[model samples]
Target: MTITINRLLLRADTADGPYGTDIVFEKGLFILRVENTHGKSTCINSIAYALGMEMALGQVTSKPPFPPSLLKNIQNENGTEIPVISSYVMLEVSNDRGQTCTLKREILGADAESIITVYESDIESISNNGRNLFIHLEGDTSRELGFYYWLAEFISWDLPLVPNNSGRESPLYPVLLFPLFFVEQKKGWSSIQATTPFHLQIIQARKRAFEFLMDMDINETVNSKAKNKKLIDDVQEKWKQIYTQLESVAIRLDGKAQGVKDAPAATFDPFKLDILIEHQGNWQSLTSALIGLRADLTQHVKASQPQVAEQKNESLLSKIRELNNIVLQEDSKYEFLLNEISFVKNQITATEVRIENLVDDKRKYEDLKKVKSFSILDDLPVLNNECPTCGREYSDHNVEIECSDDLMTLEESLEFIKSQITTFKSVLNSYKMQLDIKKIELSKLEKQIDKHGADISRLKTELYSERNVLDEESLREKIRLENQITEYEKGLVAVGDFRSTFDILHNQYKHLISLRRNFPEHGFSQKDINKLDGLKTKVVKYLSEFGFSSFDPQLLEISQDTYLPTREGFDLGFDTSASDGIRIIWSYLISLFSLREIFKTNHPGILIFDEPRQQEANKFSFTGLLKGASDAAKSGQIIFATSEEEDVLKGALEGFKYTLHSYSPSEGKILRKLNKGA
Candidate 1:
């Protein structure tokens, strides 16, 4: 059964379509639609609402994203109150069973029980043997549903067909057509991604075509001579640069010590240093044992009557003791220096590299999508006897040519730059690696240096006290400093940890910059910012080609930070600064295209358009779309609601026939809805 909207009611001032309407049908097709000004679109919208076609009926209302302080304040000029609520749409539907259904819907204030509610009119059985079925909107009506129930009704033969329902009514026929064909509009032009590898079928063709072009160009100039000159000049220049840089480095190398911030004292352990003093005492004791052994040897020599020489034995003993002392002192000094140097060097290097990487990241982000031009690129031919622009007869006018591209040009430049930076970074990284080693070295130095301060102070105190034996005070100070050094060495493990509290952020950064995707074959491409600048130049070039003025070219700019051009910018839209009528035409086209896309993907063959000729200015642009839709509707059904100028509709819908219907509370102007099928 076919169902359609017939009429609607609304206050004169509202843009929300109609508040109430009728359900009228004839034969099997819905007939007699009233425009929104006449309150029809709103009415049918209600039916669309009942059928779950729209997210909501009436306008979509949202709170302002910002406070009023951010907005312009306009006071009421006449102190007149605007209606708080928007108007609504009422629809009339009837099927083959002669069952007529009226649906009414509207947006309610937030305080209202429901954002939207449906109201169904009582079933008015139009024929015998029809069962009452006005229970579609709900099992029962309440205030929550608002005034919808009272405003709508079903009047058809099927209303009384069921047993124990109301009464029985006659049968009604089914509906035939409601075919929909929407018009599409064009917008801005955009280039598609085309640099993708040529598909297998077209790769060789592209290669051959470019090679031929290059060879033809080569014929115009002597490339071989230029290559020879470049090679000669490059080697000569490289050697000259190397010799000068080496000389410059020799002259500039500064051996003067760096300005030292006093390496803070490395507090040390007297207890450990004193172990050396204990070893000396052991040496002294050994010397006494040697003395005793020598006495015994002297007595034995005396008894052996001048067989042994005492002076020779004493000299050998002294030499052995001196060698032992030399080895131990050198080894102790080497151990101390290693710990001191490692820490400071690492800290300085890491800080510097971090600064450089951030500097490199100032220019950033865009979403990459597959380019749409891949198909066209693949289909382009390699060898052609005729012109590429037109399929034409072969002529002897053009010459054949072959060429080769310098593959090394791009690849070599990238490789060279990457290698230089990578090598420089490696040197810098070594400096960083030495940092921890330096930290440990520095701590050892501090411990060594701390004892000197104590000794100096002890000497000063002894001198102040007028003590004759300053050595005693020096010994006591050394012990105190040594105890402190032992404490510091114990804490070395914790102090040597160079890691800052940033492991988590490091993990995330690793993901962003270095995580390699599995699909490396798909590859990645980076366009130079200079390339975008080049594109801008080309945009100006094109605009000039189109006769745009030099001072104010009518070309669009695209930027990552701010994008101003949209799909509808080039060929359509109110935003395009087009004529009002043109704007409406564009808007209508877009709407039709969108509707078609949606319905084509999922069939809900219905349309509910309002203000097709909006704000009076859209009349001219909207005229064509309306006419097209009307023409398509001859084989189907479409319900358009508008408060448009009547002359415009008459002009656009000139050939189509529509039942004229009107609505009003004023007596003698009433056109109540009727169910023709019943």
Candidate 2:
């Protein structure tokens, strides 16, 4: 895949002033040159921000290369600065398929919230086009529609959903692709492949990115194994829980607690429990005996009569009726109190809303008063000699009229409005307080009503006690029989649950074991080995061309274990000088870029080098690096930023195919004055 940046726009808002820059690129090498601290890194990072791949820049400090920090504290005249209120990065990009898109992302001051917008347009018509017909990508880290996710798909990188070290699944984001594309000025010199020290997890992601780019299919197996392990652990925990509950149930039924039996070794067999139950006749006998006892107890209850005789009394019944009437009256009062409380609550809600509106109105008027008032003189009506009131031509002295000086100003009007809003808020708050007091009174009334209800219930119970005619011994006998029947039924239920628990555990255990055996261990295949060998050869070739002298090409090897270049079959990454380390990075990444075409890879065909010569002292090797990059330009796009002198660069690569945007302290910086036409 080939992606070319046609234009980049950065718009900034600062307290002192607003300024921005626009750079246009063609199909060739582009060098953005400036002195140190002149915003070269800022220009490169603007592209990453517009693409929503800011995380690829690694950890950001309070300086440039981090788009947010650069925008928040923009530079101004005489080394002064101002806080930025808003900032945006826009880019017009085209792909190998001839599809053109204008992408933009905006940030509001220091806040992290950003709006990502993209517009797909025709390449021929894009120069005069504004990004009006754009779509905003929405969602979060886990969503498929997020800005980063959409960009990855738009570039046709078929990144799969893989499991992280935490056993959580995440989609492949654009940051994962940065190791082979972006070279950070700070950490890019630390390794053959640029690394981020954000966490150990990102280290693992680096390995995953390499594996994915090589077209290895083992990630699916790895993800499946992770998911299977988590499922098995959860199932085992559930089995332990069920065993404990089953033991408690057995003990409650007057049976000795037995340890849960082992799961069956075969497939889940629901009939196994049925065969066991048939062999044990105790359960059947217990069920039969409980049923017969229940029938006898029912008949005895039906034939029994009251042990003591009662004499009817009209006066006692009348007193019971009077107590019942008091209960009904108390219930009515309780319902009324509840309704009144609800009504008061609604009234409070309305009053609070009114107060909120008034407060907002007051704030608006106060803000309006602080702003500078518009001058009426700037847009005064155009007057001519025929503008006389009677439609007759008149002289300037005759048409002259005096304006009043005592008119009310907007500030005075705003002050009156503010006072009225304050007064309305005060009245609304007073109403809310009054409603709260009413709610409190209603609560006390409800408590009193409950006490009256309890008194009525006690009276009814006392009246019923007087009417009870059964002997105490007979009541005790009936209660004992009922308790016996309940215990028998509970025992039967416990026996049934014991068998059911065993069946469910047996089924779940068998299913989990089967799933575990089906997932095989994932290892690299022959195709992976062949790709690694090809990458190693390319690395050796490019390293030699880039002027690295220490290691032999035959002895130089790419570590399959580390996916990093090794010297003499040993890890020499830390032993090498910083300049050599950068050379290794250059060779390693450009080899990947070359192999992408050989392997038909999805690399987006763009590489960014902020300052490859930052730590190197030798200018000769740096020129060779530039020469190699120019040769690779036939395959993709390379955007390089440097502080090296122009004449030296011209002499080093005399026939180099590239473009230059050089700047100096007196000539102005990369971030130029804002365009008034934009």
Candidate 3:
């Protein structure tokens, strides 16, 4: 990507006459040489103003950066000040692909500083064709009708989105990138990338700008990591929500999820976790309990009607005997189930104790590993299996015990303990399931025995009573049981549906973990590393040429973490003198500007400096800077404004090929009244 300024036209339509200046830039090096206070800085500022980028020079506001000559009043040839009625600045720029566009902005009208007029053609044809775009407004950096968006497209730059202070994303505004190549006179020389607008709330604004300029892939890498992390968090949150819902429903059904985790894990298996309910001091699986309730409801519905005709005493006695026999059989089954449930519960308790012991042992070995890592107590007798005083094999002093060579190392022991814990947990779950089944069977048998006893009582009552009537109590009991069964069935279905989604959530969790693992370890690709290395090399070379003296130029390095120049892992600004700091800034900015020659960069191939020589840099250093700029200009353009004397400046130029636009003392000023055609 390349952006080159072809011309800057500043026009002021005043009450007396037109007062402005027009300056055209060539392909290579262009120097604006003039006396002090001759509008050199004004010309430089006009370029930014016309491009709708004055915010780079300072804070963003409605006030323009131009002098009063174009804003309030202007002086005529007779040295008389004239009031200015209106003014505007225009700049024509072209890209590497030879596409040109002229930008115009008014300074003193209704559509003042916030509006920009873009002509698809060069400055000469701007009057014939133009389209109005807006700036300094919301969405100006991204909207199609915004000037920055249009400018970015024209420059062939696909701006990347950077994170802002609000924890959201915003485009890397063009103003941020301009400071890298266009340095104003006042604050641009204060530090490296000094003109960057931090108030935009862009996090690490300088580093992000550097990455975009170098075309690094770190942004995509970071975005991918953030995206996957958000996905994982979402999956976990949803899993927790589903678990909470399942728990609520389970509680409503007089049951709870057993051995189930609230958080989703790749190792989670829904089938292994049991849902159990407790009734009459016995625990049973929810499914089994529902089945028993449904059976009871069926039996109640079958027995809801009363007999219409009287039965013989012999028939009643026969029915009562049959119910008594069923009661006896069910009571025997209930006792057997009770014994089985008791044994299983004991086993479950023992397995749980074993698992806890194994877990504690694992934790101890892990702590030992940490101690060994720190080299503390590394040669302890117990840790090395030797006696402390004699350096002999240690013994536990157990007479009947025999020592073996198959003992495990600390790491191996930790692994063994982990496996033991896992095995015991599985055993505990199995025992609990067995206990649940036996208790459920016991509950069912007890229900059967009670039902048979009730039947026998009812038969005896009928045999003694004379009057026959509808059993309204039996009907009400049947209806109540049926409604309970319906509710239990609905809860069972809901829990079942929840369990089904576990597989999907677990799969999503695993996929997100895989994506996280696949991201680059350092968040930078090989290409990004190569570009950074190249930049470091150029920066050191430029520093040497510019006579950097505060430290050894060879000690300078571009930091990968902050993307700033450093000295032996420390910041260069700490020990650098004022002049050396200026030199460092020049080297850093020039190296970035020149990178387009070697790599595919977003550098616009144009560099503008209000004053390249600052901080009272020596003549040789200034000359070296000029030469460096000249060499860089071979492929692009370098425009700088200077106030050096003619002879000294001429000496500095030496053999360089450059365009000299000079305003001598006799010329008085850069902006003057235009000649009349008549």
Candidate 4:
């Protein structure tokens, strides 16, 4: 759409110039080039106010051109201020078929005291050469499309992106993806495109841009979306995998949180996945440790039979085995101590296989960007591979840890188990060695005592024969030797160190059980211990696809068909690598994304932006941004405003299409198209 403004004219009752411009357009791209400090932003914003009630650009832009009962508040910035705003804007919307529509309006000044709500004259429209009429005012009315409704007619917008809504409105949302088309010095013009989720918003915006192209179904353009169809499908497939994984994760994860028995009524309900997922998140570590413990105990039972010590208490072993089964319960609380030697081992090969799959699935998510381009991607980046909130790098080949809760490594579990198993093996092996030595020592000791006792008996008999009488002294000495031999034999009856060895392992078994039960919130009940792997996959899938810190955690509160923002706030959704230079990016993105969406359905006759430079705003690279915005304006009509023309304005909109219009408060002139080489 080639839209133009030729020496825009605005008429003041007295000597002031006309408050409007003459705009024209043809085809889809702009024919005008905006120069630096070009006052282009103002023209854009005035155009926005001209078309809609809401602020399309920055603060002050939302205020009506005139204030209600203007005398009460009367000073500009020196603490005193008079409230004023344009009552209406006149526009001549023309189609290639030579169809033209004009709109003029009269507006009431806003309540000067009120900040909670304020609006200029709402839209008033005169269609197909009709007379000027009030759209929202009392009594004196004209049905020829109220200005506000007319604005809406040009752009049908959905708020908070009603996901459950029907038709094209479902896919619309705010975005800021202004592309740069510069006059390249060498190698022609090189386009360094953005690959981020922000593009999602752009698709929504371009959808609106397509509306003005010619009265055709813009959804047809989406068929081209099929060209990137494989990519989007892959994204969806990946998203589906992500979705399935998240759901499974919700199930497999430790159920620390309970499901809602009753939901409260509100315009919006937050998503409940986080609560369930959080519950699952809390139990992950316990799940892994239990698995290791189960493994170790099974090996113990299979490798050895109960010694005589255990045979005396078969019931004790039986009780221990019962505890082991608790770990198998769907909701059984796993707790401390000796699992039974009698219990048979169940293969949890699933956990291992799951872990491998998680590793693989996660790896695929990382490498997703490498597989394809957004063949139909028409706008700026939205979902950035890197976090726009935090400056973090994400490669196509590595899983983003911050995005998903269920995704985790065995780092903690492995570290813990390694220490435990090492000590267990050491103690078990040491006892085995000691027990063997003790058995041999007992044997040697017994034999020596037996031979010594016999020697003592012979000495006594030989001495008695020589003496030929009682021989009490010899008998006493022989008795002493015999007693000493008996004591030596008693000393060598085995130390029983094997029992001590078993006791140590028994404690480890008990400790592991205790850990799982005591930390129920973080502990997986026996039922969930086996579901850890499944839980990880699901959490990773969703988080990687859409979860975000700025994710408006309130997005989780969605319910029914409506939404009431859980918490109210504004943001300029820019990516991490964008630097401090891009803080303004989020607000711009949101405004643009929303603006674009509004443009699509209602298909507004014009677009607008107001004084957009923010405090702490770095102006570098902004010229190209404006240039792109202006080029985008060509599809319809665009206007923007700025208080200052710092160099950033020059950089942001370099080499783009736009009719340069200026607002001169000193000259009392506005909407004047700046003619170059004048």
Candidate 5:
């Protein structure tokens, strides 16, 4: 599957930041051309970071390979640091099937570790509408179902949890595939993977990733061998654990195996153990010694045991029974106290609620009395010669009625409700006090329960103390010997089982190792050789175009072992100039992207190179580099950040479909400046 990033948006929540910074790219060559020391690296790295590819930026072994802050400070006229608060990066991309997603990640905040959010929508919907219009996949935000793994799955990358050389399994994350896609300005120009050699897992992971991207048939073979090695190491560790436990027990026995040096003599050799057991007399001796110990243990058990007098035994039994009954009754009381506390709390809540209602009613009545005199005027009936309700002439009916008596009665009722509210408040306070007292009593019961538990423990230990004193030394020795003998026998069986398993695994391991040792000479088919030949021709052509003509084409070759270019069958280090070395790297990278048709690879079909002008690269050679990028852009997208002028960019991008995002000191930056009001 091919991934094409349509747009990248970065926003900073600060007055002195680029709040609405956005960069747009089409499916062709794009240049984020800026002046030297401008924000080119920042912008390119932010794009990769947003895609969960930050580990590809700098030294992978660094504590944090990427910058901690995505936002850069912009100086105001007054010269003060206006910090960016909430910073985030959002990338909108689409696959070959036209399925699109927007991956958003917060660059700042306490929840940054858990801040990845994926939205399933087209780029237009995401840009024209808002984030809420899209659908979020289920469980995407959970750590167990990571967003990185989701993206890897979407792109059809086979990421397995493989064990590294250190005997620990590490997840082959998406960043393992990013070394080919991104080039950091700092160390990316130095080496293929600027990492420590001690990091064997990372090195192996890099090779696996490269093989995956290049569509090599040996990728699965390499992974299988690594996993096999890991399994063997795990089994060996298990065997070692069993051996150490047996050795510990063997060293404590009174025999030739009574010391560390002598313990290994008891080490069971699975292959020859049965033969030795019949001829050598160790097992027979161990059996005889165990029989003697058990016989002695029986006699000691009978002789050392003492009989208690009848009177004392009865007294002790009676006391224990009494204490047991008291404990049961106290446990019942403790449960009752817990229930009582819960009931008291419920009663307090009800009383408080009742008081609140009473207060509300009193307040409403007070407001009613305050507005009553004025409301009475508005409510008075108008005198007329007609009855208002029946619409008949009022010839003899009395039309006037007074509400002064009713108002007086309403005022008296308000006063009564006010008194009721005060009474409810007093009752509520009394119930609260009672609840507090019950809580104190509950605390005291808990302490008493704990004290009684300690007493019971002491009495039980005393009851067992005399019986346990019956020649514990001899009994313990007997038990230890028996356990040791049993464990030694099991150890022998385990060793036999392991030997059987290891033999099969060892055969497979040797086969894989032999294949890997002779892989470069015999592994490749004729078709694979033809593709590598094509790749070599392309690499030489690109290198010559990039102004590296000092070396002959025959002298420069690609290493079949590493798939990297070498000079005279050696690595291209110390023999080539800095400029020539970078050119070779450029040629190799461009050729990998250009020859995808021959390999049927999953290269993502995109390239991002940050600042090709580093190491004082000649402008003419740099133009050649840009020309190669433009050529590769014909098949895939090539996006690079450069510090060249507009004239240079225009000349390099003459015969291709491309876009130039120019950044200058005066034109603000990719990030828009905040207005005065903002």
Candidate 6:
């Protein structure tokens, strides 16, 4: 991608007349040379401002970066100050495909500072015809109406989404990239990417920006790794949920599942698991106990009958009849309790669903509140329940009676929903408690009915015959054994139904494990390695030529982990001298331009420097930087604004071909009053 700034026009409408400056840039190297305090930096800042990139210079604010000359007042050619009414900056830029567009922004006017008008034509054709785009608003980097979104497309750049510090994904905004190409005078010289906005919460933004500009494959690799890790996490979460559910079911059936792991494993065996129930104070496998109980029950049924005593026969028959009546009444009560429990369970489910829906609605309202905080749509009537077309208050369609004077605002509505959720949750807990009580009562009733039936069976056996009467103790033993058998059979059925789901859970766990193993162990692809190695070579070469004197220039290396300059596994910031630090910046930035020659990059092919020579570097070293920049300019454009003396500047540029825009002492300033025709 390529971005070439063709022209910059800064205009201020004052009481006397219009006051501004118009400068046209040509291909290759261009130098803006002027005396101190001559508005050189102003011209540079105007270009960035018009492009909606001033956030790269410093903290964003409503105020513009321009001085009073273009904002509050402007001095005429006669040195008389005039009041300024309004001011705006315009910049015309073209891409590698020769598609030209002019960007205009208001500094002091009725329009908000976030607004930028993009004219499809060149600077000369900029009139009232253009599309208005906004910056500094939410979604400004990814949405259609955002200035950066349009700018990226114009430069043919497909911006990638990168991870942010909050563990969420955000687009790599143009502001982060501008620090590389447009180095402001105040803070850009301090370090490499000194003005990168950390407030945006991008994780390792400096490193990510370098990777993007160089078009490294590491970005794709990182994204892939994150996605795979998320899948694995999701799978593990599901496994835990299923395991908990199985445990709950076992507990409800008065049995416990054994040998089942709670976490996902590649070698899990579902058939190894066992469901155990306590029978007569001893824990036994549910399936084995059911078989034993059935055998005992069959033996009891086939055993020979005993003769009954002649005098006790009537009493036995009477007792059996009474026990049967009791069992029938208990059975009827049990059925009614079952119906009540079912009704409560359904109600609990419906209440839970309603709570979920309310929670979702509350989340949406919270997001809407955040959007309103940006004040982007402050003028929209819908926010206040007023019709936009007719400018009338909207009626509450949900109101069924006379409307109340009080209406719930968004905050109130959120609070109301929260309270509703709390109340419903309390109600749900109450329902659960009631259900537990009913289940316990039902279990007791079942035991009572079983006891009564056992009594009746024992009494009936006692009345079998006068000659073959069964002893009362023996008859009671047979009835007790039969009841235990019936209960064991019921438990077996419940456990069997639960065991059927284990196969599906086990398969899902194994599939997730397989997917996890398929991902690459490391994130660095071969292409990423090549780019870093190539970048390291260029940086070392540039450092050597630029007189890097902090240590052995050959020992200086670019770190693979952070992509920053380092020496012997430590950063080179505090150890390097001030002058050498400046040289490092020069080498690092220029090497980016050099890398573009060999590798395809997203760099805009444009480099701007407010002052290249900082920290009083020797003339030879400065000359080496100029020579390096001149070589880089062969493929793109590089602009430098300097206060260096004419003779000294000329000596450094003696052998380099460049464009010079000079402002002498007599020229006074870069901004001047203009005539209507001029």
Per-model C-alpha lDDT, please? 0.32, 0.64, 0.82, 0.33, 0.63, 0.80
C-alpha lDDT (0 to 100) for residue 605 of candidate 5: 84
- Model 6 spans with C-alpha error above 4 angstroms: 60-63, 74-83, 243-262, 272-279, 283-522
Candidate 5 lDDT tens digits, 26-64:
877788887665567767877776776665666443222
In model 4, how large is the Cα lDDT of residue 2? 22
Writing each residue's lDDT as its tens digit, candidate 3 over 45-84 gives 8888887778899656647898889888888878888899
Please report the candidate that would top lDDT against the real structure: 3
Model 5 — TM-score against the truth? 0.58
Given candidate 6, what's the lDDT at residue 132? 91
Q: What is the TM-score ranking, best to worst?
A: 3, 6, 2, 5, 1, 4
Q: Which candidate wins on TM-score? A: 3
Off by over 4 Å in 1: 1-416, 421-577, 580-600, 614-622, 634-637, 657-678
Worst 10 residues of 3 by lDDT: 306-315
lDDT of 5 at 537: 89
lDDT of 1 by residue, 1-678 (tens): 123443333211222222122344222112233443333443443344443333122122222111111122211223332332333334445543454444433333232222333333323422333222222233222222322222222211121111111222111110000111111111111111112122212212222222121122221122232333344444345434433432232122110111111121123221121101111123122223334444544554343322122432333244334434543553465465553444435545564565465334321111111222245545444233455767664643365433463334334544554565566566665565455334434444454456444444544444445323324532453454455334333322212221121222233333433332222321211222333343344444433332332234334453422111223244223233333333333232223323322222111223444443433334444555555455434433554544454565666657765433333223221222223331
lDDT (Cα, 0-100) at 373 in candidate 6: 86
C-alpha displacement of 210 in model 4, angstroms? 15
Q: What range of 10 consecutive residues in model 6 has the weakest lDDT sum?
A: 465-474
Q: Which candidate model has the greater lDDT, 5 or 6?
A: 6
Candidate 3 has an lDDT of 0.82
Pairs with steric clashes in candidate 5: none
Please give the range of 10 consecutive residues that has the lowest summed lDDT in model 2: 272-281
lDDT (Cα) of model 6: 0.80
- lDDT tens digits, residues 604-644, model 2? 77778888786663887888878888887677888888888
Candidate number that wins on lDDT, 3 or 6? 3
lDDT of 6 by residue, 407-430 (tens): 788799989989998999999888
Task: List the candidates ranked by lDDT, beginning with the highest.
Answer: 3, 6, 2, 5, 4, 1
All-Cα superposition RMSD per candidate: 23.7, 27.5, 9.2, 26.2, 32.3, 21.2
What are the models' TM-scores?
0.33, 0.60, 0.72, 0.29, 0.58, 0.68
